[model samples]
Target: MNKYLRRALAPLAAATLGLTLLGGTDAVARPIGWTAAWAASPQRPSEGFTANWAEQGFSRQTLRQVVRVTQAGEQARIRLSNAYGTSPLRITGATIARAGKGAAVEQGSVRHLTFDGRRSTVIPARGHTASDPAQLTVGAEESVTVTLYLAETTGPATFHAQGFTDSYRADGDHRADVSGRAFGEKTQSWYYLAGVDVTGGARSERPGQGGVALFGDSITDGFGSTSGADRRYPDALADRIDRPVVNAGIGGNLVLNDSAWYGERGTARFERDVLDQPGITTAVVLEGLNDIGFYEAQAAGYDRPTYFPAPRVSAAELIAGYRSLIAQAHERGVRVVGATLLPLGGSDHYGAHAARVSDEVNEWIRTSGEFDAVADFDRLLADPADPERIAARYDSGDALHPNDAGYARMAAEVARVL
Candidate 1:
């Protein structure tokens, strides 16, 4: 018996027995409901990674994107991340409006944030942060617009896409305004603005139910997705699914134990990111490439200075680790899905040596059949001519991350299975 399993089961079995003995059945059964999940995409828009550039005429200024709710009467929350920066970001103000366009050209008390009595907050670059709950009285299908203002930036920002669809031009170094008018009416924007918390409310709505978790790496985390596009696959998929889809992807996450890139391995964060989620029913895990690619990229007899080390686990080791993860999820009654990696043949993140590891890991993912369901993202988006390469059509020019269109393809593919 695996040590982790032994430990987990013993306590659970004991608790179950105790409950049975002590009339635990008297406890109310909490209905499982879904929450809105959103994540930035790994693809970059035509303006490049930075949405506010001097030449682009949109820099220094902050932008706003509003997500109006299509379904009303449910509670909602806002989540934010500066997941791709090398430094910290200081936000001057963040606001939620009644589905308005632009910054409102003003700030008001109506702004609901994930903070305690504060209009401004700071987010560490390369890390993620969630806002305090903002309660609102919404109708059956109303909308709420969220606007954010930042002081400084070190790297380009990435965001989930479904809520707001308009673009922006940075005003200067200190400001940017929402561009044009909302794509209102028939726009059918799919990304979320405020996440519906639906955990506690009148049983009348019967909102609580099983939720889907977008469990994976940066792709699920929205690493390369356009800043304002809200086109990341997870966001796209969330818009398509009627149930809640929470984004649990962390940038640079790996499947097997290796070095720490973003605090801990994805497996280590699994309990917190997936199981601990408020109400998650299904989990789609898209990981492993980082372990394979990073491992293969290491120097034959040298060490790199970065905190993250590469390709530590062999193909067999990763397979074993994956099986363990699947078993764990199944034990908890959560369905586990595996996503084959996109090609890395030309990514600056990959080298010839590293490429081999990616290939090996991908092959195992296809044949292992360990996952409850498989999301063959590699085949759907990878270049057909060069099986080991991301299709040019999908490549975001970085050769590793997908473009907006590519992410759409990914979202469509996964939606089909769901």
Candidate 2:
């Protein structure tokens, strides 16, 4: 066993063997409390900007990305993923430190991250690796910069396309650099890195202190929200709640079927994205918008036969999907909190039939009692004059996603239930 795992599992081993030191003093091991401090859902490289990343794989370069963590801790670990890679990924070195002004690390705060005591390791295709715990103190709402040096060519890297936060890239290896001088290029997506876990410390001792995971589509993904500011509804909700909040949303994602541009369907990824997250006691599901919107486009005869397939879905089918998600969460002892789909009346794909279906599904969410609780995002963001449309002030001009103000209101609504 790796040294870190052995250390982590020592308590379990001693308990299983019923052994104690010669003095008969019971050796009580300190429980290692892990909490999901930050996370970004991984997605396959698709067309447009993301495809460019797939083509230009990293070689002899350093990639430094900043992630804002919700839970504070005295020690932390980093998770790197090659979930969709076509070849092995080798990391020559890596460092984690408190983020400074821009693309820079705070002086005297940089710490080396190791894997089972090794400074470097190879991640096989479709696999992931987590670093050994590093002694780096961080406070809640602090941004941490993780720098990685790729010694080999990484082909078709698995990445989260819409990080909405700037990441820096520079030629040659600079994983140990403490300043931003080496970085020359900026990108707005997170590559390879998947999650940041922190030792729970005192927070773990509190009753019902487990984190909340927000699972949804673009709205939850912070599409219309301001970039680099973390203004998503989940972010706002996290600011209000004491427990950690992890955003598992993907832009253009669907609940039942996978789209080319979006990542996997919500049903397919629920276990890995939500159920597998450490310390997640509650899952707030807000999906089905794209599914309904696509079906509406097909009904309106706006779907291109070659590009877009004709979508057929009903309110019953959507409710069944929700029920499946709720049952899965319940099986894992995670409270399921359903969120009603927001209004999209002014969207280009909105149709009268789609509006009716949305109403039917929302009514089921509100009255079905299948979920432990419900967040009425639809009611909160809908226009008072026309219940079908979103309020003018809240709409992001796309009608599909919400503006920062709208997201704040959505967060306020979710806060009441959390």
Give the top-scoring candidate (TM-score): 2
In candidate 2 the C-alpha lDDT for residue 49 amounts to 55
Cα misplacement distance, residue 25 of candidate 1 (Å)? 30
Write candidate 1's Cα lDDT for 1-418 as tens digits: 3232232212111211101112376765332232433322211111322222211211244455544332333344555544444457566666554554443333332444645457666666544444545555554233455555555443544333222244332333222223333222122122112243432333223433355677776677665678555566676776676655666665556776634333356666576456544445577878777776655555543354432445456667777767777877787777777777788886655666556656776677778777877788888887778877888878778777887788888877777766
Q: State candidate 1's TM-score.
A: 0.61
State model 2's lDDT.
Answer: 0.82
Candidate 1 segments whose C-alpha is farther than 4 A from its true place: 1-73, 77-99, 105-196, 199-209, 258-261, 300-307, 351-353
Candidate 2 similarity to native, TM-score? 0.91
- Tell how far residue 190 is off in model 1, in angstroms: 20
Candidate lDDT values, in order: 0.53, 0.82
